[model samples]
Structure formats: structure tokens, C-alpha cells
Target: MGGGDGGDDSVLHFVFVHGASHGAWCWYKLTTLLDAAGFKATSVDLTGAGINLTDSNTVVDFEHYNRPLFSLLSDLPPHHKIILVGHSIGGGSVTEALCKFTDKISMVVYLAADMVQPGSTSSPHDSTMAVGEEDIWEFTYGEGDDKPPTGMLMKEEFRRHYYYSQSPLEDPTLACKLLRPAPLRALNGADKLAPNPEAEKVPRVYIKTAKDNLFDPLRQDRVVEKWPPSQLYILEESDISWRRVITLLFSLSRLPYSLIFSVLYLFFNYNAKLHSWFDHISSLVHYIKKSYC
Candidate 1:
């Protein structure tokens, strides 16, 4: 990624949240593109997803996923503002984070996200079902299920239909390697996130994937209607070919490794600067925590 603009004093921080069955790796391509465009992008993994994966039993709630993001946001650069971009179910997490750290955020971009309304019992979209007839995957909800149930794994055949159907062509190996059982609690959490008037006043962008099987075009339109975005774009129409898709997916999958190595490099080569920054942020975090309490 390119360095911050030397002339402009204002620095932009982009925080990306991925959708269901996806990790931070999915934002790899977008991060690269944003970096080229002179913005700093950080693709985050929810508590139970991506590099944060631990025992499934431990990640059975929404707060579990939210805390990690909160911790990350708490330590951000004081001079920079954040732009949160959430895809699919990630929108909810972004919404929750925004509620807590509204002062730190500048904008929110929902890419085919689940637009939840306040006091709504169900999510706007049926997250369990696949999009088209070509894709057949059953999302089973147990009896008396209030929050989205956990422990459900996607069938291999269904995975082939939905994710790998478009890109990787007949190559299932890449898709299989990327697949993992997503935490159901994150999907079914009861916390309500309606359109905040304050948030609506800020800049919001929505990017719709035209060929998406999970989130249909009509559903996306409904989301846009309820939470009108400042800007919209169609990915497939915007020269986003199959090769590009593969490249993007590959990059998103590798973000954790990149972040790890980046931290290691900083620790070894710039330990003093990194420590100084951490100490500064620690004081800020303490102040913010006390004030909020």
C-alpha cells in the first residue's frame, strides 16, 4: 500500500469487515486498490473468524466478535479518522462498532450488507438460504431458535455451487481451502441496529455485486432504500472480471499473514517508535475508558 499523502495533513484509515464464510482475506484486493489510491486500509477479522479462530465453543455470542474490533479501534492513530467498510453480515458489526466509536469514524460502506432495522426480529435478508436455484444449501434453525443458531457447516456441494461457481471455474481446491464454518451467533445476534440519523448524515457508500448468489439485486435495492447510500457501484459492471475476483479473494485470505509480518518488522526495526506510539495510545485509551464509564 502507498504511504499517506505528504501534502494533506489529514490521513484516512480504512477498516474493512468481511461477510459470512469469509475472513479478512477477502478484502485483500480492495485494500491493495485503496493503497494504490493513497489510503491506509486495515482488514479486520471478527473474533471467531480468520486469524482470530479459536475453539468454536468460546465464540458463541456477538460481544465476542465486537470486542476485538473495539480493541483495534481504541488504539487507532489520534490524528486519523476511520472509514469502516462492511460486507454482508459484517454490516451489523460495523453498525455496532459505529455506535460505540462514532467520534472516530468518518464513513461507513455496506457492500451487499444485511441492513437491520431497530426492533426487527429478523434480519432484512434470509441469511440461511442461498440466492439462486443453481445454488442449493439448507440453513437449518433448531426449535425455539431466537438468535441465529451455531454449529451449522456448509455442505461441500453447496459451497461449490455458491462461492466457486463463478470464479476458479472448475477448480474446487482453492475454494475448499478457503472454506470454514462461520460462527452462527454473529449472524443471529439480537442486538438491533437501525438507521441512525447521525450516521445517515455521514458519507455512506454501497457496492452491489451484480452476480452475487447470496445477496440478490432486489434485496440489495431494499437495503439501499432503507439506508440510502451516498454512492453506489456495481462490481461486475465495473471491469471486475473472474480473474480479478480470484486475485481479490487470494489477497483477503493472506491479510493476516501480512499483518503479522508487518508487526514483526516494526518490532524489530522500529521498536522505539512502535513503543512510543503504543504508550501514547495507552494513555488515550485510559482517558477514553474513564470518560465513557
Candidate 2:
């Protein structure tokens, strides 16, 4: 499943949404894999993230931060539909997009993300804040000493343990160099993720990381129970396992939304044999196509 034969040239696009303090750069590996499989993959940098020139301090609210995704969706061809994948707090932005452009989205996937209720007011950063003040670097740049912090970044010392403990050494190193300060106001703003009827109707798939340090397994379970997805797959690995998990997940694209449940359940059982699982899964896809597709 690392690379497709490029035999199917249909326009199946994947739009990846990165987590807080991260950028489009983080999705490099996954996007490359998707592209190899003859699929179109795009990763967007939220305002004040990635190479976007917007200053982090000036990002006033969640909506402001999500402008890039909205603009991309608005400009897409009417016949195109996308698979939106969100990681961590990017789930909020994904939800916002779902509410606004429900018709344009074919499916939504949340990977160890903040899959909160439609009108939840709690900040997605609440979990990070619980990690203790020492693990973060908060700043009030350009503001007086009396004002609240304008931006925040995970302290370099704690970044590895909290985010990349199970990842390769090089991934954490790249993150340290590229990670930027997340706008504090925007993350902690009063904006609510209010979902509409259309958004709720869209098929959703939630992927949980068993060893996720930032969003623990318990929290992931709670969110899933609150708003159950069309299908759920738990990776007995780290938050960074998208690189390995995405290959099999994308292969399931040929099956219609209703047919993904049983196939996904089988994927988790053979996840340990990830390297060779693709061939088996590819055969499974052929069978599904013959029987259901």
C-alpha cells in the first residue's frame, strides 16, 4: 500500500489538517505516501502556522486561524469532494469546515483529535495546560506586563517526551526547528464549534492512538463515546503512527462509506504485520469491489 499502480486516475483528494503549534510541514511523510498511491493530498498551514506570513500574536480567534482551509474549499471545483483528516486540535478547524462546507466533504477523519461536542465551549488546550506550567513557554510579546499571554510554545525540553516519545529521533529534531508559537488567544478564544444538521450527517471516522502522550487513550475513548463515529480504529502506537496507519486506511477509499466498518476491524487485527498487510488488504479491496463496490 506504499504506492498504488497509478492505475486508477479518479480525482480522490485528501486534505490534511495539522495540530496546534504544528504546520503543513508535519504532514510531509503522510502526504508523500498518499501521493505515491495515486491520490491527491494537500496539507494546509493555518494562519500563523507553517510558512504563512501571518503573525501568531495577531490571530484573534479560531475562525481567523481557519481562513486558509475555508479559502481552499471555497475555490475548489464543484464536482470535487475531499477526505478531510485532522490531528489534535485541528479537529476543531475540521468541524468548522464541516459545518460550512458539508456538501463538499466526502468523509472526515480525526486522529487522536479533540472530537468534542458540537457546541462545546471548553478550550482544546485545556489538556496541554494540565501538563503543568513548566512544560510550556508562554509569551506576552508586544503587550504590557499586565496583559495575558499572546502566544505559547511547548518547551523544547518537554516536546520530545510529550509529543514524539515514540517517534524516530529525526522527527522530533525537525519539529524543534520548525515548530512555532501557537497564538494563545486564538486557541483559548470564546468561539464555539457549533455543528449543523448537514455536518452531523457527514460520515466521520475516528482513529485513536493507544500511546498518545498529548491526548491520552482515556480521553480519546471519552470523546468517541460522546459522539460515535461511522467507524473507529485504535492504533496501539504513538500519535505519529499516521505514517504507518494511513496506507491501509486510504486503500479502503474504494469502498463506499457504509462498507468500511468490517474492513477496518480486520486492519487492526493485522496491524502488526504492517509491511506486508498491504498486499492482503489490496486483495480484500478487490473482493469488496466484486461483492459491494
Candidate 3:
């Protein structure tokens, strides 16, 4: 399903935030697709990720995660309107950003992302929360050395199970090289999301990745229910044919924006007109039959 408004805006700016154990590099395919589709897209690395990987001291809390986003928004071209997209735990940061900078954002897109309520902290095993697990993939920096500091590096096995399962086209060598240790404090830090009355007025789109093992579709639905979106979309992994998974992934790479806008359009204008009265009647009959059965 589609989510936001797709107008003839001069430039659609997409700010993508990756999930835990992931750096900005994760959005490479998405960025390419968005650019090709005529949208200007940039993926931001949280303080401890990608080019900013060495900025360990700067990445201790949620505030640290917001630093790069705040800087990017502050420096954006005066006329550009931004659509902030966050994946998994990054959703908390995106919501925080929207609360902090309501005027600069056109919409916020949560891609199977966390949609935590204000004044709430992500719960352990909440996949949406940033807590690090004791799995082999997460290796603390000081595990065997006296250099005690930062956190652990993810083991290849864990990464393979969670992150790379869908990246069949990615080179094995490059995927291994891109792996890095995430900050422990950042993972354990309590989320400090605040209520934003303004954000309520701002449009929101939530994309549910149906096959996500970490963020199961049912759990994702619960999160969405807590903070209902202007529009919701379910991108079923099963929908992607074996041969077309790559192409589907590439085509839907810019979906965070396209889907949002489409949903907005449907919600405001086309939804009522598109539904047939007969469909409702048929649904009622089916429901009644199921109830009796």
C-alpha cells in the first residue's frame, strides 16, 4: 500500500537511517534506485557507523544518533523538503527527529521500524529497541584484550542469519568487510522520545517487511497499532519471486518514499471511490459465515 503525498515537488529528499549492526552502506542499493527514480537520497550513518565509525566517543546515546541527522537537516538546501526514513531501531531516532524538527520534514517513513510511544524506552527483544544481544555476532572490543572499551563485533554467523539472508547478490567478501562493532551503551540506552503534537499533524507511513525474522510481521503490526500511521504497507518477502527478488528489491528500494506518497493520495482522494459496495457486502457475508462456523 502507498503512504504519503507525491506532489510535483522540486526535489524529494530521502534521509535513510540503517538498523543496528548496519552502517550507511546498507542503503547503497536503495540510494541508487531513488536517484534513478528522480529523487535525491542520502543515507546517514549514526555516530558509530560507516564514515563516522571512528567517532566512538560521540555515540553514547540517542542524542548521539540524532547528531548526524540534525546536521544533515540543518545543511539541507533551503528549498528542499525532506522525508526521513528509518529502518528497525532507527525508527526511534526518526521519530525523535520528527519531534525535534517538524518543519523540515515532509513525512516520516518507518520501514519495519520502531514506532515507540513518547516517553517510552524500547524493550529488550523488542527488535525495535537498540539493545545488543549476547550472540556470537556481537563481540565486545575488550573480550580478549586489555583495550577494554566500546562494544563487540558481530560474528559472521549471526550477521548471515539476520542481515545478509536477503542480500544474495552482495559479494561475500565485501559483506564481511562492511561488518563492524556497535556501541554497547547506544544499544542499552533508554530511548528518550518525547510527545510531539506537531508530529501528529505531520504525515507518517509505515512499511512492514513481512518476512523479517528480527521484526516479525505480527509484532510490527502491534507497533503500528500503538502509533497508527497515515498509511500502512506490507511488503511480503514471498511476493518476490526467486528470480526477481533482486529486481523486486531494487525496484522497491525507493519504496519508503513512493509508498508513503501513494498511500497519502489514496487516503485523501482515491480510497472511497475505489472500494466497491459489492465488496463490502461480500465481506459481511463471509464474516457472518465464519462466525456461525
The top-ranked prediction according to TM-score is: 2
Residue by residue across 1-293, what tens digits does model 1's lDDT show?
A: 12374454555677988776667877776677667545677998777677776644356677676677888899886656677878777887887787777778877777667655444455643642446555354344543457455644557776655554555554456545765556666556724565455655556666776766667777787777765666665555322323322223223321322222222222212222445644553454456445643
Put down candidate 2 lDDT per residue, 1-293, tens digits, no spaces: 11233444335678999888899999988688678656678999999999999998889798899999999988876555587989888887898888889988988888778776577665565753455444455565647677877888878888898889887899899888998888877876523866476788888988888876678778788778878888888777443334445565666666666545544444334455554655666677778878875
Q: After superposition, how far is residue 33 of candidate 2 from its true place, in Å?
A: 1.4
The residue ranges of model 1 lying beyond 4 angstroms of the native Cα positions read 1-8, 36-38, 117-122, 125-149, 169-172, 238-293
Displacement of residue 70 (Cα, Å) in model 3 is 1.1
Candidate 3, position 209, lDDT:
74
User: What are the lDDT figures for the candidates, one per model?
Assistant: 0.60, 0.75, 0.63
Candidate 3's displacement at residue 288, Å, is: 37
Estimate the TM-score for candidate 3. 0.71
**Higher-ranked by TM-score: 1 or 2:** 2
Model 2 regions more than 4 Å off = 1-10, 132-134, 238-253, 258-283
Give the distance in Å from residue 91's predicted Cα in candidate 1 to where it truly belongs.
1.4
